[model samples]
Target: MFEVEVKYRVPNHDAIRDRLKALNAKFLEHTEETDIYLNSPLRDFAKTDEALRVRVYGDGTVVLTYKGPRIGNVGKTREELSVTANDLDSLLEILRRLDFREVAKVVKRRDIYNYENFTIYLDTVEDLGSFVEVETMVNDKELINRATDEVLQFGDKLGLKREWIEKRTYLELVLERGNERR
Candidate 1:
């Protein structure tokens, strides 16, 4: 499915949470997530703008996700394929044997909300601070444009300013920040 999403850097997460409640958004789940992003030895994911990661959530659920390059100029719209994994260790081992190296790990506390067609994430990311992501899944490629527009509009309804929108993933942002400190 296509994951049409938009993220924003916000100063106060509590304010946004209140706004979501005001809009009648449903509280989903609060989870601590650690995402381990891997780099394929054959292709440079950094140059290609693709991602493969294993996310382990607080409730002990594990998910493996592959994210394709971003599409369009407006938001972080992309093709995302994900599945639940029964064994995180085995999956990591398989990736390692396949020459995929661990690139970065992002730790975050996420509060999820459901509002209409969107799954909203209020994330407190370690080293990067607070942000919100609104996303929806689309089955058809033709629906990406309309879905992107709708997601951005929903973000605006949550009081997210256009200028505050961030297109870079947390992994990219963290890697860039690390390089800058060198």
Candidate 2:
């Protein structure tokens, strides 16, 4: 699976949300996510087109997403990856193990998402600004190049960057900024 995403420097998030509503779309749920970006001893991500992610924790609790199908805060998405071990009840039981800094459910929407396959997903986040994603299920070098190029195009169109992209999770973003003020 592959993920192609870009974070835009939103001017007026509320205004964007309002405009999205006029288009007959909505976010899914606001989920506060805590991510641990690992270090790869092998390659330079700055120039690479592919990334590998493994479900270390919350394997059963959270649905792992590979393809993001959403444009704008109103964009929709479909789960490209779902990790279910035994049963829903048993799954929920395992979710109880990992520690999360913050968990905000996404506010879903009904718009459009395009990738190797078409899918619709939801997104509603808090203290992290409005964002969208697009992923594809391809790992080949050629495919990764294509997908990464596509994502970069969107990022360029939106005037985003690999730098401005928040490397830290939202919970960390909040805390990092808060600590900066002190």
Candidate 3:
């Protein structure tokens, strides 16, 4: 499946949550997430624009996700594959033994909501500021264009301006900030 998403760096998160509430969006869950990104032994993920990470959710569920290179220009469209893992430590140990090195750890508190076809996230990361993401899953590759359009329109309805759109992931932003401190 593919994860088509659009993200924005917003100044006010409470306002967005109020908007979602006004729209009668279904409140999903509010949880904290920690994502540990790992680097591949064969190639540079930073240059390839790919990511592999293990996300540990607040409720103790762990997920392993692989995000392929993004497609198109309007939104972040990518081939995403994820699976739930029974043992987080074992999985991490396996990756480590395979020579995958830890790159960065991203910690965030997220409020998730669902409206129509979109799943929205209001996140506050540890080093990065507030962000809002609207995403949907599609099984067919041909549906990505239509899905991207709908995501952009949905974001617009939520008062997200074009200038507020952000392309960098939380991990990228955190790593960049660390670099600038040097």
**Number of the top-ranking candidate, with TM-score as the measure:** 3
The clash count of every prediction, one per candidate, is: 0, 26, 0
| All candidates in order of lDDT, best leading | 3, 1, 2
Query: Better model by lDDT, 2 or 3?
Result: 3
Which ten contiguous residues of candidate 1 have the minimum total lDDT?
Answer: 72-81
lDDT of 3 at 10: 95
1 or 3: which has the higher TM-score?
A: 3
lDDT of 1 by residue, 51-139 (tens): 99899999889999999999888778888889999898999999999999999999999999999999999999999999999999898
TM-score of each model, paired residue for residue? 0.96, 0.42, 0.97
Ranking by TM-score: 3, 1, 2
lDDT of each: 0.92, 0.38, 0.93
Task: Quote the positional error of residue 6 for candidate 2 in Å.
Answer: 2.4
Error of 3 at 28 (Å): 0.6
Q: Mind giving the per-residue lDDT tens digits that candidate 2 earns over 41-111? A: 45532234222222222333433333233323211212245443345444334334442112223222222
Full-model lDDT, candidate 1: 0.92
- Angstrom error of the Cα, residue 51, model 3: value is 0.6
Q: What is the C-alpha RMSD, rounded to one decimal, of candidate 1? A: 1.0
